[model samples]
Target chain A: MQLKTQTRPKVISVLVMEDRIDAATAIQFKERMRDVTKDAPARVVLDLARVQFLDSSGLGAIVAVKKLLGPDRALELSSLTPTVEKVFRLTRMDTVFTIHPSLEVAVASAASV
Target chain B: MPPQPVSDHDPRRSSLTLVFQADPVSIRQALQGMLTCPPLSCLRGEDRGMAELVLAEVLNNVAEHAYAEAGGKVEIRLDGDPRGLRCLVVDEGREMPGGQLPEGRLPCGPYVALDDLPEGGFGWHLIRSLCADLAYARVDGQNRLAFVLATGS
Candidate 1:
């Protein structure tokens, strides 16, 4: 699995290419993001188009990253699969963060800000 | 103690129990059974959604991550009480991940700030939000995960 990070202006967009996110990789994921964006004000866009499944641990890691961001920055989500999307909707997380249909829109919105 | 009132009954006594392999399909079936209490057929939309999402995540963790691809047996026991549903997942796998919060301070929900955009931490948040209690332990190379949710008051 590859987590590619790109910085455009103030935006940091990440593409996740793993079929599933669960306990096995949740911590690794948290560490990578924490290490990559250390103290940076990044409008992160997580592209989950390739993620076929997402378990609770994976969701926790995402929340952890959101916590790390604090009160100033923006954490955007994009390309959530239907099953994955169902999870967010079921948990009412769709109301918590900014979700986008595509990475381009996420980046464009970040750029506009 | 003297004979207790029916209203004071412990829901644990009414709980249903079952065991299954640590597979996604089996887990799904078990959850279906847990959510639907006989005469009720299947659970309603809300309860079914919660049960499916929570079980899918927990069981997937057991089958794929906890074992780390090494084949092993996982035992699941479920109890449905008037208080709510409780589940225990027992597995002889690698050491369990030390992911537990102190007492009642379980952290649940996504972070709003952009700077805190955690590149990955979101799974536990989902679990915490869906269930009333979640506990974990590693004993003699066995991982035991217990979760509980409350029903009507």
Candidate 2:
């Protein structure tokens, strides 16, 4: 799995090209997010349109990334598959982060904030 | 802790082995049976959640890592006493990722920082956190992951 990063002004976008985000892909996830967001922005959106599955580890990763951004920046999740959504709901993390239907919507929503 | 008395009709008093191909639905069914079968009554709601999380994560890992490229077989073994449950997942596919548990868990306890959670490193962390003991071994072209979850009486 490869984590690609792109910066657009106040928003940092991360694209995860993986069917599942588990222990194997979590570190690369963190490094890429950290590398892209070295300079914090007002909003950070992760485009998980391709991810079909996520576990607690994956959830923890996102939570860690959210913490890295601290309370100032907005962290938004986009394009979460149903299984992935189930995991978020199971862990009750859906309430912790902002989730959107698509990357465009997530980024746009973050931009609005 | 003392060994609790086994209840009548307890299935876990005897070792159980249930093997399923890389089918998610079947896997869940088997898990449902294994977790509920008599002696394992200790697995209630919260333990059910924990089992679901652990099973989903590990089985998905097997499906992707073991059978992603070419279909392969996955074997699940359950062994336990009245004290706790042990699950072993063995897959005949790619080799297990090589390395020790991440350095982050050096000081294990609650109040661990969420920010310190490594994005990808959460697999072992979650397995370690959810289970009392975890061991991994690659034997004869198979990745065997053993999980031990204690049910405090």
The numbered model that scores best in TM-score is: 1
Cα RMSD, each candidate: 9.6, 9.8
Candidate 2 residue lDDT tens string, B1-64? 9977767556655566778766554555665676666435556655555665677667766775
Instruction: Give a tens-digit lDDT track for model 1, residues A19-52.
Output: 7665557788888878767755557888888886
Scanning candidate 1 chain B in windows of ten residues, the lowest lDDT window is: B99-108
Q: Identify the CAPRI category of the predicted complex in candidate 2.
A: incorrect
Residue A31 in candidate 2, Cα distance off native in Å = 26
lDDT of 2 by residue, A1-113 (tens): 57777788789888887776654466667767777777857888888888765675567677777888876887789988766776666444666677999988877776665
Interface C-alpha root-mean-square deviation, candidates in order: 6.1, 6.9
Give per-residue CA lDDT, model 1, range B81-124, as digits (tens): 54567777788866654444323222334554444333433445
Model 1 score (lDDT): 0.67
* lDDT of the candidates, in the order given: 0.67, 0.67
Of the candidates shown, which would achieve the greatest DockQ relative to the real structure? Answer: 1
In order of appearance, the predictions have TM-scores of 0.52, 0.50
